[model samples]
Target: MTERNTDLEARTEAKPLPRVSPATDILEREDGFYVYMDIPGVRREDLKIDINENEMVVTGRAGQAASEKETFLEVQFGPGEYIRAVSLSDLVDREHIKASLKDGVLTIHLPRLEKASPRRIPVQSA
Candidate 1:
């Protein structure tokens, strides 16, 4: 019985934590694109954003605030990690990308590349 309990505890400790994807919204304009994500209970310091090649990844950890001395009578929500990955197109300018988080909402701006932006060509007379 002791060996069985030890094995179970080891397995549980080795298991990876589940990940949840935050709700996101992507919008496109003539000049740029906007991305909004809802990540409740995640602090700014716990969030990470990375861009490599044509992919952008967003990650955040929503940690529980209870201390070691605190005891819960009824447990509901627990700690969780949030992750989201976005694919970038050739038209987007990766150098000028920007992001901001406010009130649990993360907003990312991806501007269109200068060469890919629509422009009116002037007509030439012979």
Candidate 2:
């Protein structure tokens, strides 16, 4: 009988991770904008955000969090990557943008530029 190469067999059996888009919501306020995204199974260390040329990119790697000792019989959500991009407007102040992740929820704050904010002009009676 011929011996088989287990390393090569494992490599061929490996499947590529899936790519998914997380549910997102954007809310505009008088002072700025708030973005909320639902990205479950993603860890803080595996998340990345980048801003360039009026575009904001968000990416995260999500996978099963169970320990190796725990074996899954039926799998619904497998390993995957979450990606989303937003086109920023000129009114946004990119320098002051902030983001946070809590309980599988990502929140982003995009503050508007001072000059771009609305102001009330005083009415003078002539």
Candidate 3:
């Protein structure tokens, strides 16, 4: 019998992940700004909301991992992550930003800072 020696090498390639952009609507009013986004299939546990001094970021993933192998006749949705970033100014109060997710829609409330709101000037007799 003869002895043999073998060696194996492994290689890896870097790839970029896909990102999805959800439908969003921005409304501006005298009191504040309202942001509504449509993110179907996303769950509360998979959602993330980040508020910065000058920006807001939202990211989430839709659907759950399959327990077993399955087949699909029609597939309209794919496994991906939803990401969106919005720019903000000093007029918005970052501390008061609130968000809620319901019925596959994400709502964000951005209240205007007091100094940013319009005030009526009072006149006085000299």
Q: List the global CA lDDT of all models.
A: 0.83, 0.82, 0.76
The positional error of residue 33 in candidate 1, measured at the CA in angstroms, is: 0.6
lDDT of 2 at 91: 93
The Cα error of candidate 2 at residue 122, in Å, is 6.5
Residue-level lDDT tens digits of model 2 in 5-90: 33323322476556789999999987799999999988999999999998999999887565644444555566678999988999
Tens digit of lDDT per residue, candidate 3, span 1-126? 011111000101132334789999999977699999998878999999987768899998875343323434444455567999999888999888889999999999999998878888999999
Q: Model 2: how far is 76 from its true place, Å?
A: 1.9
Whose lDDT is greatest here?
A: 1
Q: Looking at candidate 2, what is the lDDT of residue 16? A: 54
Writing each residue's lDDT as its tens digit, candidate 1 over 1-126 gives: 556444444433565444889899999976699999998889999999999999999999887565644445555555668999999999999889999999989999999999987889999998
Backbone clash count for every predicted candidate, in the order shown: 0, 0, 0
Q: Name the runs in model 2 displaced over 4 angstroms.
A: 1-13, 69-71, 120-126
- Candidate 2 lDDT (Cα, 0 to 1): 0.82
